[model samples]
Target: MPYKANVVVRYKKSVLEPQGQAILLSLREQGDESFLDVRVGKYIEILLEAENLQAAEEKVRKLAEDLLHNPVMENCSITVSQDD
Candidate 1:
């Protein structure tokens, strides 16, 4: 079966995000205080063949942890769906 994976990699709650803070400052300066806080991260989607939905999810998770994100400072999650 073929599956689609949606991955999100973001800094841990306890980690500091200088880029996000800079963006927040800019937004506030532009009079956009609508956001309480902002954090920047990566979003990736990939399609791959897998034995099953569980296997697809596992592969996606591994990619996220092994390549897409830094496990010590970041957290990652994957959502899987059938491509067919």
Candidate 2:
């Protein structure tokens, strides 16, 4: 079976995000004031072949916690879906 994993990485609310602020400023300057309060984060989608959804989800969660995110100042969420 094939599984798709989505990893969303974001800085903790208590952490200051300079990159997100910079991007937000740039967007505002470009006349997208609608994004004035928007916070930017990293998004990644991956495809994997696994024996089952549970296994795929476990692997994806570890990948997010161990390699995809900085546990020190970031929080990560992962979702896994099976492909029929």
Best by lDDT: 1
lDDT of each: 0.89, 0.87
Query: Model 1: how far is 77 from its true place, Å?
Result: 1.1
Q: Tell me the lDDT of candidate 2.
A: 0.87
RMSD (CA, angstroms), candidate 1: 1.5
Off by over 4 Å in 1: none
Per residue, candidate 2 scores C-alpha lDDT tens digits across 1-84 of 899998989989998898889988888889887875656789999999999889999989888877899999888888899975
- Residue ranges of candidate 2 with Cα displaced over 4 Å: 27-36
* Model 1 poorest ten-residue lDDT run: 58-67
Candidate 2, run of 10 with poorest lDDT: 32-41
Model 2 lDDT at residue 66: 72
Write model 1 residue lDDT over 1-84, tens digit each, in one string.
Answer: 989988888999999998899999999999998987889988998999999998988888888877898989988878899996
Clashing pairs in 1: none
What's the lDDT of the predicted structure labeled candidate 1? 0.89
